[model samples]
Target: MILRQHGPQLLHHIKILKLKKNLDEHLNNLLTSPWVPENTFQFPARGKRNLRFQSQRQTLESLSDSLDIETSSKALSFLKSTLTSEFVVSLCLLANILQSTISVYKILQSPYCDLKSAVEHTEDSVDHFGNIQRTMDVKFSKIFITAKALMSQVCEEIHFPRVAPHQHYRSNYSTKDPESYLRISVAIPIQDDLINQLKCRFSDRKDLLGTLQCFIPASTTETVDAEPLK
Candidate 1:
């Protein structure tokens, strides 16, 4: 969902750049640039698609400087317009939040994952998300600061979008600061959706798995009643 919401612009920019005749050459130049890592421009499919986009973002940041104005001006312009402070900050927050979800997903996808472990991991994830939602102010402060530092590396400053004042005809939220505005508007809603979805998805399975745990020999004891199993 995060990718669906925030990825299109970056992806579009990348696609356009890919069509440019000089993009590859520029990227090759970037690979050898002493200021950036040797693999900075490499977009290998190492894991999930979301992680790939994370890598792509890093690649774009590194390549943005090397893009030839004559050959890739449109792509460079698109990158400049799209990769704003707000976008990068939001992306950082989403990436941090989704990392836990992705870890759980990978575990669940593994052939070795069992029902007991799956239930435990899912519950842990729910708790993790709950903690994030509860402590969003403190949590988002750190994330926002980290994002600001990251943006600084690219020579961009964190700028909040203008929020309209309260009006009878329209609904508006008056926030005292950018952190508060983002915490109220973006982080909270996404965390709420994620927590709710995890609970809804696992609620039934968790109960059933709890009941079925009795069948596992490691879960059984001499005092265990066979009546429930029957």
Candidate 2:
């Protein structure tokens, strides 16, 4: 599953490509700094969302940037189109996770990253992602609270059908409110998925990496298939 950077890459789901495109276009308008200041907010060089492992690792590294004119303008326009506090918060959260994942991913890419280092990085990433429901509650704490309040209203309205939806909401609760749309209480399948992928990809490479160690040291004998000269 782990291929070289230039090897064949899969196509990304349409949703991912759209999310990245919109995110790239509006980097200037979005306030990603309070959440993640390290990101440069540059678009991935490859247009396809299903990035190669190397590409994904790189894109995660620069998922946000300080606002520039064009990016800012696009962000502003985007904000105007979808103005909602919850939506904004979710965007901030997305950037945050991406930034954290970038650190681990870079470690995995290092030429010196041996099986030991790879396992450590993968474990750290898995810990950060938090597959346990309660831990997720902590990671997405602020958003979790907001999402809960939103979900409550949604369940009451959908099942009961007697409760009237908010009439004066600036954002539409009747259709898809961010509060209801993004559920923080449940395990985040996306984060869990990435963690699983990392484990499955790297766990089997121990023997190969160990053998490479011999080749790395200059003092080590080069393979002499034939006997040495007398």
Candidate 3:
């Protein structure tokens, strides 16, 4: 004979399991539908890939709707927090940067790629990111516009965060507009960091490639000298 357990804890656990099952079913249905444009119902993939965040940003609106608010209020609230203008703008900017970075990364990862090609591609990507940093205002404005367009589709408007007066240990830049604040606080720093990281990662490789170039026939001149080789 076995003892039967009956308690409020068991009842609550059953309800929680049922809720999770329902949420899973809803997500499966959304992902399985092929009729949706761009299949926007797909959730962000889990990985060490930047594409995950890009997908998350793309499906944010649809994903938010898929959650049953009454049952998943905490999840809904957390998702909604990312829907803010600044967050969206940052997402757009990061997606833009990562798309270019991934393209270069793919080429570098190709089996056929040579040292020269790798250095060239790396430098090109660094240059591209450098340009964004140089013309940050213009580039960030475009990203901001794109963010606004995306938010508009979700019936949301761009709004700046409130600045508290005389906050403790706060480094205020005193920005009066959303664009200025976001550009300074988000876009510029991200772009700068990307550029710095790329340079740091590729600097030694570039030096090595340059030193080895003299051995390559294509890089050699008809009148190659010992000094040039050295």
Candidate 2: worst 10 consecutive residues by lDDT? 154-163
Count of clashes, each model:
0, 6, 0
Winner of 1 and 3 under TM-score: 3
Q: Per-residue alpha-carbon lDDT of model 3 for 43-69, expressed as tens digits?
A: 223222233333344444344444356
Name model 2 segments beyond 4 Å from true: 1-90, 131-133, 144-181, 184-187, 206-230
> What are the per-residue Cα lDDT tens digits for candidate 1 across 21-89?
444544453344322354222222223333433444545544554445643455466567645755666
Model 1 CA RMSD to the hidden true structure, in angstroms = 12.8
Report model 3's TM-score to 2 decimal places: 0.62
Against the true structure, whose TM-score is highest?
3
Would you list the C-alpha lDDT of every candidate in the order shown? 0.66, 0.48, 0.67
- Which residue pairs show backbone clashes in model 3? none
Off by over 4 Å in 1: 1-22, 25-81, 101-103, 166-171, 210-230
Residue lDDT tens for model 2, 98-139: 656766666776789767678777767766665443466456
| Highest lDDT model number | 3
Candidates ranked, most accurate by lDDT first:
3, 1, 2
Comparing 2 with 3 on TM-score, the higher-scoring candidate is 3
